[model samples]
Target: MRLSARLLLVCLPLFSLPGLAAPVADLYQVREPVASQQPEERDAALGRALETLIQRLTGKADAAQSPALAQLRKEPQQVVSKYGYEGDALLVEFDSISTERALRQADFALWGANRPAILAWWLNDGSEGSSLVGDGQSAAQVLRQAAQYRGLPLRLPLADLSEQLLATPENLLAGEPDALRSASERYAADAQLAVLARESDGQWQAEWRLWLGDEREQGKAQGANQAALADALLLAVSQRLAPRFVVTPGAATSLTLEIQGVDLKRYAELQRLLEPFAAQLSKVQGETLTFQVNASVEQLRAQLALAQLHEVTEQAPATESDAEAATDGEPGPRILPRTDVLRFRW
Candidate 1:
């Protein structure tokens, strides 16, 4: 049976509460343009592959036909393909219990025991090959490792300005909406990130213009261009939104969060030290604070252990999809279908 595929957009949480216990936000920097990959096709392929695997596992070709398996079977294509492009490699593939995996790999996963069931099938294939070529992390592991996505920056389509302005910086200073719009469209990306800076008499002004696509919204705010100010506004806007984000554990059943102690001074110190964790926090009363305090303690110990376990580095690890497995095996180039899982385009 053919598995239908669609683009799945998972907008992870923007701001985590201040004093978060563990580094909950997984940060990802896109080094490649993720526009051309086709997740729908990938999902469809994944669905078909799983269906075949299940049949191989239980000796049932119609295993996917079961009503309980309907969702996975229907959207298999949307479930597997993720932010892939030509010449890119898969560094990690985590199979978590949540649908968020679909958005991260730019692909999808069949929830419940389905993950293990699929894995079972993959193992049984005995083809001496791994069906999913990620770094061997489960779906849940991958999701937990991914950083939260900051909200999209504004995108503007500027009209072509008169050619006279292109000749000189002085004329360029006399800005035009069309020119600015073009600039926004050019640098503004699928993630809606923009860069606008202005200089006035030794002062550097960085401006971030947010475009609201809703029809009822109009007008914009222009604040003095200070990096701090720009950063604050961007943080405020991005952090204010609650992304439809959830973490799926690597195993079945709820994951236990064991909180150990309550220490405000320690919490405060940890907060300052862990500022680079790509999350925000707010003051919560009583036990919440205590819980986080202990969590941070555990986290610090873990980080120390991890650092001891590996080489020190100034950069984060690279993220990739399971497709990286196909790289050396196939000498020829391959083409994958493209699908827009989420629309942030202005």
Candidate 2:
């Protein structure tokens, strides 16, 4: 039988009964040109900065005339905004900006940041789109939503969990029932998504698959020759995970994202699942996105305590006022930690 190798990353957080809800927050990393401003002017500066940023990123020769910009140019009555520093970049959030202009500005800004080849883009109102939109479940869905927010159309290449599972080594791979039941709970994935991808060598392909029940008969075993195994497995994966339509970009590129806000101990399995893609990844920033072991003094103290080491000096005290204080005069919602952490200095 031919040997076929496939690397899969499964992202599913642990779940509890109806009482506990899985935490949801936007996790992001954007390249820097950090914004600093006074309290009152901060909103306008950030908004203009984002608008200028969109123009820069999209490579639009005329910023004002662009359709996307036209939408954002007309300011909203209630422009909710927030901002903070994450490593090397400023993380900002804008809510209820009236039209799609704010999104347009941000999208173009990300486009300008990444440039001509967009990694991915999607916009979903949860129900109107695939499971990848609102309350997006799978890794692919999350990636798609991120891309959409940036106005890029980079799609994932794998979708069918069963096909992905079966393609791996016998010991590493699980079957339908266990794979679906276990992976669903583990990865926070719904039953549907679409994926498009480009190989490391610059070949574009698409695939998609839905979650089918495990009770059905296991597909017949195949013992293919060495050369055929790769082709066979690729076909299967593509059939199950391909997008409804595929678009070929002039350039080959992919986006690297780092998430925070996750409990490192609780997500070890997901981290392991993501390891394979990490290895195959050619274009990446920094090292693996590990937990922020020492973001604050308290975190450092916690680590020291866990190591059972004696404190060298008395720890500095932090106050409830400081904890509750808004980052940059914005609301507290902007302070949410990144869920999937990356070490990007950008």
Native-structure RMSD, model 2: 23.0
lDDT of 1 by residue, 1-346 (tens): 1111111012112222232122222122222223234765444445544453333222233545777666666755433334333454222122322333332232221111101000000000112321221223342222122121221222222222432232233322332333323433333222222223344454434333322221111112224433333334333333222111112222112111211232343334333433322223333233232112212222233322211212122232333433464465743334332221111100
Model 2 regions more than 4 Å off? 1-24, 27-71, 74-80, 84-88, 97-188, 194-205, 210-346
Q: State the lDDT of candidate 2 residue by residue for 1-346, as single tens digits.
A: 1111111123233431211111122312222234454444544545554553343333343444566555455552234355666654455554423223454444432121111111111111122223222223344444443333333333332335443443322212233334334434433332222222212222322232323221121221111321222233222432232221111222212323332222323234323323312323232122233332212232222222221223333234555555676545744433433333332211
What lDDT is obtained when candidate 1 is compared to the true structure? 0.28
What is the TM-score of each predicted model, taking all chains together?
0.20, 0.25
Candidate achieving the largest TM-score: 2
Name the TM-score of candidate 2: 0.25
The per-residue C-alpha lDDT of model 1 at residue 268 equals 44
Q: State residue 275's C-alpha deviation in candidate 1, in Å.
A: 26
Worst 10 residues of 1 by lDDT: 115-124
